[model samples]
Target: MSEDHQPETGEDETVIESYVAGCPIDPELAGQIVRLADLPWNDRDVTDSAMRGLGWSDDEVPTDEARFVTAAGHVVYGDYCLYLPFAHSYDVGGELWPDDFWGSLPGWSSQRGAGREEFEAHVDASIDRFAERLGPPECDVRTEGRHLAIGRYSWRYAAWRRGGNILVIGPALDGFSYAQDEEAVVYIGEFAKDSPFPDAADFLNLMHT
Candidate 1:
């Protein structure tokens, strides 16, 4: 799909676009996911049971939001999510570090037990780990920008598909803004028919076997 599928004008679309980029799924399906994710699920223990099966103790489970283990082994958090399948080599540096959730990285700051060199090394290791699961590198490392930004191209999930090499951008305000391509973001709304709890048991059992 080309990147031109996103709406170019409208108030609601503008607001939604900030959180959602290029969504290939049906509008109705996307709406369903968003609505389901927004629900409080206040009168139920739906999320609890799923987390327990996924090896999460009661303490690790979040009360306000939910976390899901993607088929590729990366963890995704939130209901209304923007899934970015990581496909490019990054060039992040001090300019992009120590801000928002990106600052949460272990060595983004000297106070976090790492200097600039150590932090860059940590990022290299992370890239290596991801590459091992995905494939070869296409671009070299770059370091320019106060905010972490991708280049003009990146592969994203086609639609409602799951698994594979991807970065799950949650309904988080701090960590995301716009993809370099603008249309590389896929809006994901995950929900269950019977309940809001994730079906971690089935996947957990599969993982064990």
Candidate 2:
């Protein structure tokens, strides 16, 4: 799936961890998964073990493409599914020092708008309005620019960095990063529940549960 693709729901409620840099899959893999799953369970076709090898448990076999795919522990986008375990990512060497990486970032966040158009609209309006109040941005991202294409964004203070936040806007699985100190992208904790960036955090909060 494209970076902007948001994650869909699953039965276990555990958001499949995909979209992280380095771990990439074919965007059409889900359709293939559905097709492979759709085939009649004849010996000539895919076997149960083969299905399991693709990350489907015995009961995970899809009876209905839409329902089963969404319910599987995999991150399900429009027509693609991500088997997170097989995902490969190449990390650029960067040292996030002193702070605990997980602690600095948000704990379990969601998206605001329902879909790309909806989410983009919300982001555009909110950021524009924020810029108006702040009186000219350090950098104008009034458009839903390419930055979000990576599925995550990091910002602080008036700009994208310290005291700022990071956003995961993938359609299959959305999340947030509160800040990045030095090398580590900080996860959200109790630190900035009340944001200083106008309605920035508040706006994104609507999409997340």
lDDT of each: 0.29, 0.28
How would you encode candidate 1's per-residue C-alpha lDDT over 94-175 as one tens digit per residue? 3332122222222221122223343233334434443443344322223122233422221211112223212222111123
Q: How far in Å is the alpha carbon of 57 misplaced in model 2?
A: 42
**Native-to-model Cα distance after best TM-score fit, residue 75 in candidate 2, in Å:** 24
Q: What's the TM for model 1?
A: 0.28
Deviation (Å) of 136 in candidate 1 = 1.8
Question: Residue by residue across 9-60, what tens digits does model 2's lDDT show?
Answer: 3323332222122112233433343334333333423433445455644344
Clashes per candidate (backbone, < 3 Å): 1, 30
**TM-score, per-candidate, Cα-based:** 0.28, 0.20
- In model 2, the worst 10-residue window by lDDT is 180-189
TM-score of 2: 0.20
Q: Which whole-number lDDT from 0 to 100 does residue 156 have in model 1?
A: 18
